[model samples]
Target: MFRDEKGFRPTQQIFTEVPPKYDILNRILTLNLDEGWRRKASATILEENPSRVLDLCCGTADLTMHLARSAKQSAELYGLDFSHTMLARAKEKVALFGEDRVKLIQGDAGNMPFEDEFFDAVGISFGFRNLTFENPDARLHISEVFRVLKPGGRFVVLETSQPNNRLIRAGYHFYQKYITAPIGGLLSGNRPAYDYLAHSAINYYSIPEISEVLLEAGFSKVSGQPYLLGATAIVTAIK
Candidate 1:
């Protein structure tokens, strides 16, 4: 693995230990809404008819597969992640799309392998938080996304968000703390990881806040679509 000052190795290790159960745990934690969210993100990306699309922080290629299933046959797709284990599982799952159709790579998000302006679109699902929340290299990660995307390209993010409704927010946080975290930890055998995930999901930014972050990173335009009463959102930014 490459050396990273942004605390990448530890995050890599956490996902490394959980990839086998990662997909299932995600479905359970979100009550099976994760699939729908990724599907929505896929549609949003394909709607633009981008020729080259990359799934940033792809993580087991769930979103990549979704993109492949929906994208035009001529579209080129790639999935990138830092965890060798996660990418291994992703490789197995994405192989059905054929190697010529979907490529998988392992690298740090803060320093990707692709050249600048290499992709027409980039989509990340449920993995954007790890690149931003309390991360010192957050700006670097986001800027890398901007660097790899073409000037008119789109960046779509499907991630957990803080709800505006006080009641819904409270219940969401409570469920994450008392139910999802413990169950996810138990099933995945990675309590520390699930603990961090729960904490981050509970404290992640609102849709507007994320839009601001993207704008600050030099995106031309940003918009969002909320789901589950704002507990989750799909934010799209134009490069």
Candidate 2:
């Protein structure tokens, strides 16, 4: 497995240790807006009528399920995440859906296990920020997405973004630093992990910077739309 500078191994332990409360904490922290964001991201792909879609860094496959349900066409969805525990949960979710349309795979985002031009669309939600730090080569995950998408395919990335509204931004910062960590600690017993999530969101690229990276990855027309008072942004690019 690839190791970041911090020696994080993308292990199953991270998810297994926090699996029971992961979705609950997510809903509480986002006030249930997370589902709406996932729906919006899925809608973008569905509007394009893709037949085969790839969900990169698909923790627990929630967004993958959303895409499967939302698509107008009969779609085959593949979800990839490095964590086995997360994949297990994803498989459980797929079983509940009772459809063989969704498949989950254990794979790294930077180096996927698929041939080039194999997918009609690729989507990621709240996961790109964990790719790496310091070395921009770690950002090759975007390039890999590009390589796997067929010509004219679409890519959607939904991630947390710094709010532009002053008051909202201040409130978000406070909540992330104080409220989120404590609540996550109480629920998941992993204050440090939640703290890392907050810190990573704080340090991640801005909308324009992320757009530039998508452009660098050979996406033709990259655009970003802010959501929930700019607390998150959805970026869409066409290959």
Candidate 3:
């Protein structure tokens, strides 16, 4: 059964509860590789030269801010997340770039509150995995992404994954378990949260499986690029 199956408040609630320390713990847990991953994912949007972009799970607006600054053709950026605390920080960050170029809203990924074909591109960073387990509703999220994007829109996702190389995988597991979790717990006082992070990475589907999901979700062409020695991956699909 999924973690939320047993009367747990939604993941949004969990994020709200932990919002105070979420960014700090995230930086510590990834040793700041998290930012680099977002950078790589945002590059895909740049390639598409999208004028309007949607960033799902735009926690703290890190990627949203990056896109606003970097994408030469990106004139408007919309960030959506369920947690108000996360959105609050994101709003503050977006302000640094001027409110006219960026907007932040509180919304669910599986059920985005946006119109069909409203955006030129969509990007998700470390957010899809939190939508649901084995994500039965994943297609809903993808469908919404597809629906909100104009024809020929690009959808890009950056997520954690198991490395194929045995040696690197083993080392990655060790770091996640011993080094990442302990530090995360110390910083956030939420050992279980960090444990959940590690477990999700271990139990989530392989890149190929995720690519299949994207295709089933109605994306025309799906491709994945592995990064950080395959500890993380970015999947790009066209609507």
In candidate 2, position 86 carries an lDDT of 88
Task: After superposing candidate 2 on the true structure, give the runs of residues whose Cα lies further than 4 Å from its correct spot.
Answer: 1-13, 132-137
Ranking by TM-score: 1, 3, 2
Tens digits of per-residue lDDT, candidate 2, 28-105, equal 999989999999999987677888899998898889889877775467789999888888888988786675778889
Q: Pick the candidate with the highest lDDT.
A: 1
Q: After superposition, how far is residue 109 of candidate 2 from its true place, in Å?
A: 1.1
Q: Give the higher-lDDT candidate: 1 or 3.
A: 1
Higher-ranked by lDDT: 2 or 3:
2
Instruction: Record all residue pairs in model 3 with backbone atoms less than 3 Å apart, i.e. clashing.
Output: none
**Which clashing pairs does model 1 show?**
none
Q: Which stretches of candidate 1 lie above 4 Å from their native place? A: 1-10
Q: Which stretches of candidate 3 lie over 4 Å from their true place?
A: 2-6, 9-13
Report, for every candidate in turn, its global Cα lDDT versus the true structure: 0.88, 0.81, 0.79
Candidate structures ordered by lDDT, highest first: 1, 2, 3
Clashes of each: 0, 0, 0
Q: Give the per-residue lDDT of model 1 (tens digit) for 57-117.
A: 8888999999999999998999998888888898888889787889899999999999999
What TM-score does prediction 3 earn? 0.91
